[model samples]
Target: MSAAPPTVFGIARLGKRTKDLTKRLQPGDIAIIDHEDIDRVAAEALIERHPAAVLNVSASTSGRYPNAGPRILVDAGILLVDGLGDEVFEGVRDGQTLEVAGGEVLLEGDVIAHGTDQDDVTIAASLEIARAGLSEQLELFAENTMEYMLRERDLLLDGIGAPEVRTVLDGRPALIVVRGYHYKEDLATLRPFLRENRPIIIGVDGGADAVLEAGFRPDMIIGDMDSVSDRALRSGAELVVHAYRDGRAPGAERLEELGLGDEVVLFPASGTSEDIAMLLADEKGASVIVAVGTHGTLEEFLDKGRAGMSSTFLTRLRIGSKLVDAKGVSRLYRQRISTFQLVLLALAGFAALAVALWATPGGQALVQILGARLDALLSWFTLLFSPRATGS
Candidate 1:
């Protein structure tokens, strides 16, 4: 006879890439990821998946930087187990039912691995330590930036090798969305900008889905096509596949399989999908580039967990003042109807209404009636107080 199974916390879903793993996650599932220092973007994706718990093979923070991902996970009421090590992966496969209790991972009532069960208190304290060690990280980041500039000086100094996209961006503002840092809130905040400007919308990977969710169709979709949905790909937007500098595009394989081989343009460049999207917009003569959910600060850049982010830093330098992030979107877009403008609009509306009323016989009669009523009220006031409106 088989032994009784231990208390089941959730069903386990395992994968090395947190982004890919999130695609398979359902509510009440336990996500097993190998992501190190999980960035804000990944955490947000995981939170949306509604996982009951997350068991990581690597340290979620590693004191590398004050990454907000771990804190985001804990705050969302999801259980987190840190640094379970590669041994956990050896035994665990995808879709295995497991129990997580008191920092111990149990498979069929047998303890297979142990880890640190992280909560808000633990994550907050680690973030403080990560902030203290940020100086070293900044120095390293500077070095990487210089090194990247040397490698891609042409792309940075001059707009070289940007793809010839079919979308007309000339003199029009471009809004690039990424599935990064507070994207939902940022998108919501840009509703005024959306209604007023009607900027060319560009989505990076899953951001296309986000754009659709926010009630806008992307004018262009740029990414490796891994995380994007087939529905987004078929949404009549121009697709730009990001390729490596060596001209290798693994994402192209998926596109071909979906019978969309002729529907894409390959943009071979280094850096991230977001970086390439900005470059394409800039080269296409966009009046300005507005970014949503992309990394902004030094900490967010490092939290992306790759050396290629140096290209994003340099991409900003390349795009220069034309690039605007979501935090500054409201400031740049104070183009909203000002008090003076509102007064002018109100006056124009009243003038139009008055002209229409005077042009109609019924309206003219109504206006004459109102005028007579006004004169009667004035005469009554004058009679009631003789020389003044009051007895005084």
Candidate 2:
């Protein structure tokens, strides 16, 4: 037979980019998967890429890892290796091969290591048993967590936005809040929602950049002291200062720097910027509040590295249907670029290159500079066009 495949290690760290992992996977590349706690949406996206084999980093079928990753991998007829730890991974890299026979794994380590081929029946049966047990646990865990967060929400906001406040203008519609980095991505997804009739735009801190870059202007800004620049704050948008739960207006210091105290609207809330935005829209009786880049899940909260998203989880219920998470809406309204756009853009690029190249003695130098600029522009563009690609 041809040379046996090299053993591969699976990573289980939080924030592990599954796309990156998928890119590294060659056919027959074995991966040690980590984190059984991945959400359904994220897990499905990862599994659709199709890695060869997966070994669960955790034993005991714990719901602590992503439920969907392992479950889908198992169902897709991929190998499911469980209970292997760091040492096992290291051993694989050190030239050991894993062999399973009967109901047990056999491994040998040396300059060149090998493993026994285990019976397929035993492997399938064992994986199925573990999957069944884990799926039940994960479903229960998600249900309980969602319920718990919803209950703990208002209490977390107490002495904060508990009293609530409104600042919407009589003639202005509710502001559509957005953040930077993925401005184009946000705009593309939001344009359909804003077609013809639209919500007044608002910027939270740096979100003003998001607004302007997307060719829109902010009607209001909501945040603490830092992030929002002088030019942005003076953009004639209404300013709302989100204070701490204890009523300490921390951002007031910056507002003083700009001499905007009289113009500031302070609302104390123990939630995030997006949360405050949603609350403001509701309190002001805005018809609807649409948010971009708003945190909507445990993974997002964890990505934020905060101990609790209890406030965000709670604030949603308070707003209920009045609030729309832009992320889900963005996904739904994502536009597919036709092959025509790609072909036309390619032709246009080639024409631009030809013109620049034939223009002057400095044409090549100019072309080099232009190329660099285009690369930078594309780098930024990908932040909107393909977020996963950037991470990879």
Give the Cα-based TM-score of candidate 1 against the true structure.
0.77
Error of 1 at 260 (Å): 1.5
Candidate 1: count the clashes: 0
1-392: candidate 2 lDDT, tens digit per residue: 75453344332222234434544554444544444443343344345555444544444134332233344455565555555444544544422344432212344522222222222444444445645554454465466557645544554344234333344443445655545223457677676566665777778776775677677778878888466668788877888888886679879878887888878877766557777776666766677777776666654554343445666766787778877656655556666888899999999999988897868778878778989999999999888776463553
Best by lDDT: 1
Cα deviation of 89, candidate 2, in Å: 34
Once superposed on the true structure, which residue ranges of model 1 sit more than 4 Å away at CA? 1-8, 93-95, 328-392
Estimate every model's Cα lDDT from 0 to 1. 0.86, 0.57
